[model samples]
Target chain A: MNAPSANTLGANAISAYSISAAVPLETAAQLEETLRHIGATRYHSLHPFHKLLHGGKLNKGQVQAWALNRYYYQSTIPIKDAVVISRFRDRATRVEWRHRIEDHDGDTGAEGGIERWLKLTEGLGLDSAYVESTEGILPATRFAVEAYVHFVRDRTPLEAIASSLTELFAPNLHEERISGMLKHYNFVNPDIMSYFSRRLTQAPRDAGFALDYVKQHASTPAERRAVCNALIFKTNVLWVQLDALYHAYVDGHVPPGAFVPAK
Target chain B: MNAPSANTLGANAISAYSISAAVPLETAAQLEETLRHIGATRYHSLHPFHKLLHGGKLNKGQVQAWALNRYYYQSTIPIKDAVVISRFRDRATRVEWRHRIEDHDGDTGAEGGIERWLKLTEGLGLDSAYVESTEGILPATRFAVEAYVHFVRDRTPLEAIASSLTELFAPNLHEERISGMLKHYNFVNPDIMSYFSRRLTQAPRDAGFALDYVKQHASTPAERRAVCNALIFKTNVLWVQLDALYHAYVDGHVPPGAFVPAK
Candidate 1:
């Protein structure tokens, strides 16, 4: 097996299907290490195009393309989070993941990550109503995002949170995005970047709890592998978003009916 | 906006979202003309890459990609047809579309379009079992197909049949597909082409009845436009199928974690 980047699976190594584990558990730490390895090697922030996106090398069309495709992911995160919330018998676990939902849907107005994402879309000249309507998201993005929702709804709650262990790598993502977008795109402002800023603080603290629970609860080797594989699945979800974005935007091609940024 | 693709809006075209006129008193010829127009302008059979696909220009990967992605569509056809069948007010329409489900699903063992499609997948080097499980199909394909099922499940029977309007354009697609595969790929054989031949014989005859029903029964301009718009939306659904396939296959870009064709 490959050594995990950053002692975890970061973004660079994405497996189409996670390696099924068939091993004895040495200890909880080793299981934790294996899961973290999945995060360090396979998490999404490492996609090259995201570097371009955050670094501001992309044009307004590209930025609009990013936001539009990402909207599919943004709109569904709450639903996935809710799926986790619905399954937890442990109120503490439910209470913990509940923050993730609140973090996305937010409270009243333009407060949460989703609303903040709308601001980013608005900054890129996309209509907020259209962005919210999700009329313009890539078909792949919608499919891929909904698949994640299905996973949470259908899988065990522990597995659902395990899927979110991709967040264990989020602090690093926030770091790169903050500096990169500020450097690259003139349209980006710190105000619009507040969404990531919040996620930056929130994701790791949240992921830490999830990681702790999985390592402690997922006792058997197979169970631990499922936990690890769930994060890998989550990374693929994020990675596919970039795939759709790159095919539509960076290649100077959009599918026949996907979002076309303003000329 | 761009003159609507060489087809002028008919003098009788509904000008707004307002309710259309009461059901037109029309000959069967008029009913046939309206559905043919919908097929010519709106069915996904007219999509560019679909034209490319059925014209024998697609590479093996492209065909595999189509087969893989389209398995989602083909598999869902029976389920959606079942939804439409369930909506039948009369024994006649239900009996008619019941043949559609039976034709796609077959009576027993390896007989239906679903089974024939597996033969095509086998020819493409995909495992017949995995293909049947449909575990690896693109999420976009799943959602678009499921949305079609849900549309049939949720809407009035007229709109449900309206959604099937894509079949109005299918006879030519089936021919193009059979000829294209036989011409382009050595792996394709008569057994694999059985599905297309069957669809060629069935789609138009089925479409003929539905079109006549819609034209005769959509008494008001509102209902007529609803049917037309329903057909248009069905086209969009079908078009998105190709859009996802092209983005994934023609472009050699699969969505993150979707099935990858083996050489």
Candidate 2:
């Protein structure tokens, strides 16, 4: 993690990013555009490694690396979803979000996304206990995952729901991952990619629900701004994970005492 | 701002910093020590620019920068304090915390910390309206400052109070800054330094009351841990500001558009 060579983005980059132009987005569609712009520009979906993974270019170990690292995110989803669930006072909203927990945790063994995620890790030759320990996960990954949990736990219920709108884009990301990895990575099995398959359906419904919730509930201009800002914060949360991964593994200055793959 | 690259703590340096032997400490004292540790390591007191400003090494422009950036933090104090105030159901606790708001916002002209802060800003030749607009502060500074405000708003009351325990450590930092800045920076007049003088007596008293409350109230190990974690998080909240500053000014990649000094 050597001093990342001064500012990673440089001063000009900061100014360019901060020099925000105020375009009045007129519709929820326009609002959606704002959210999407953040994702297109800021989401981990745009990260180069993701491009490599989805384009069918990754090797077995690299795919293993992705699965192993992503496991922390998978495990934390229910916990984070539960935080959102706890915030819900409306019986209907709670009932809907509660299904999300069930979807990830599954009613019984081998049923939910968590179980399917295990299949991916198992396919990658990761020990379930080690994976569950989450000790070996990149600290950056841990930070990003936990940050999402904190977001739900700490934000106003609406803002929490708004932050989860990242899921709206997740379905698209998953489809590309499945197709790209299937076509490219020989070590990956379509069977093992079952987790993304569930996400393909689950993320969209959840994202739609969240997006509609934000659109409808963010009734005031100020509320709309908060919702927009919430999504922006969330995009950063995901992007920071890549920043960590790139810095740690790709950039070769991995923080000391973090997971080091066997040579 | 352009995408911030992976911030490396230098793997080897981070590694060397990680492996300390566990010398068991009193759970209570250990908690206190952990809180103090966060203050020592992450608190804004450690920022080198703080060193330059307080040690009188900075020019008028730098002092202006310090006042400008710091006012963002000071302005939010009452708002954050108010949220914490709202949480206190006990009339006495609420009454006590009420003083914090009064101290920061001022009851009348020539009184209160908020008024004093403005005086300092004016003394530095900043327009009151410009400082109020907060148009010139760094984005990182605003986020970090808001994070503190949000912490008090979102956390449980005991933990919110526990987070304020940084005040116990602050009086000393204030003393250092005041003495050093007074000695080093000619732009810093005694009246501008008056804010620290007031904080010297006030912060310690406020902190003493808070420390007693935390020690007496956070009796269980789990509660103790939460209190300790709040302090740690609070420290990081402050520390990240310094990291942002160093990355910008010191590293020379000053994220494109932070406070640029007058030529």
Q: Give the alpha carbon lDDT tens digit for every residue of B50-74 in model 1.
A: 7777677787767877887788788
TM-score of each: 0.79, 0.65
Docking class for model 2 is incorrect
**Model 2's lDDT to the true fold?**
0.69
Candidate 2 residues lying further than 4 Å off, grouped into runs, are A1-22, A32-35, A44-76, A79-98, A114-162, A171-201, A208-227, A240-263, B1-72, B83-95, B115-158, B175-194, B215-227, B246-263
- After TM-score superposition, what is the CA distance of residue A119 in candidate 2 from its true location, in Å? 6.9
lDDT for B152 (candidate 1): 75
- Which portions of model 1 miss their true places by more than 4 Å? A1-18, A21-31, A88-90, A108-110, A216-229, B1-42, B79-97, B133-162, B208-237, B254-263
Predicted model with the maximum DockQ:
1
Q: Indicate the TM-score of model 2.
A: 0.65
DockQ of each: 0.23, 0.12
Give the whole-model CA lDDT for all candidates, comma-separated. Answer: 0.72, 0.69
